[model samples]
Target: MERSLLTRTMARVPGPVTVVTTLDADGKPWGFTASSFSSVSLDPPLVSVCLDKGASTHAAFTTARHFLINVLAEEQHTVARRFATSGIDRFAAGDMETCELGLPGLHHTSVRVACSMHSIVDAGDHSILIGRVEEAFTSDRTPLVYYNRSFARPASNPDRAEQDIRASHIADW
Candidate 1:
């Protein structure tokens, strides 16, 4: 299958925007925006997020003992873009606060999952970090969605809903 074709097909399937955060050995926070996050199990409470092997924070996350997954709210699209950009101070915005499990997390998110590293699986050009859920936080806010390479929100009233795809400047990771 063609890579562009596969990318376009997957883009049509909306995904929740999340920023996965972890601290380096020096205790400095590092993170990357990801839409490839999912629940893997419930018995031992496992969740997984895919990190591009080329991501700037890839090394930090792959070696970290714990991490946090912040499911961004609809209004937090900017935060997602900031984290996704390479060669910039993703944490300079100071929007993150120390939260559950003492990991940096974005407040007012739709959900936050704190996890301890369980296992790492090599998958093609990415590494799948499967984590054991240590704690979770949730709010009633609507989660931000990434669809068709744009930021979106679920329509509250489909009948009268208009397409609201905000063009995003985030580069593909």
Candidate 2:
């Protein structure tokens, strides 16, 4: 199959937007905008993110056991773009707060989760990094999504903080 066609096909796979953040060997931070993220296990609370082989953040993540997943809000499209691109300091250009793991988490994101690498799977084109959630913070804001090769805001509101079960409607997912 043609690579461009395959990319286009994959692009249509609508997915939630997340910026996987990790600290480099030198203790510098790096982030990548990714839609290839999902919750894989409920027991013990596990999350997964897929990173491309050529991604700058990949090597850092390979050695770093801990990282943060910043689930973007619809308003954070610019943040996503900055992190997705190269040759610029993504963190220096944004307003952010550091997590306990020292990963940069977008302050305005709909949710932020600090996690330790549960496992790493060697997928053909990308590496799938599974994470065990250590701490999570959720906000009552609509999420940012990616679809058809572009960014999007959620159609509805996502309650701030899943601190209470009553706030997360099962129907939202």
The models' CA-based lDDT, in order, is: 0.93, 0.85
Instruction: For candidate 1, list the clashing residue pairs, or say none.
Output: none
Query: Per-residue CA lDDT of candidate 1, range 1-173, in tens?
Result: 99999999999999999999999889999999999999999998999999999888889999999999999999999999999899999999888999999999988999999999999999999999999999999999999999999999986975444323222324324
Runs of candidate 1 with Cα error greater than 4 angstroms are: 157-173
For each candidate in turn, the TM-score is: 0.89, 0.84
List ranges where model 2 is wrong by over 4 Å: 157-173
Task: Summing lDDT over every window of 10 consecutive residues in candidate 2, give the lowest-scoring window.
Answer: 155-164
Q: Candidate 2 clashing pairs?
A: 138-161, 139-160, 140-159, 140-160
Q: Name the lDDT of candidate 1.
A: 0.93
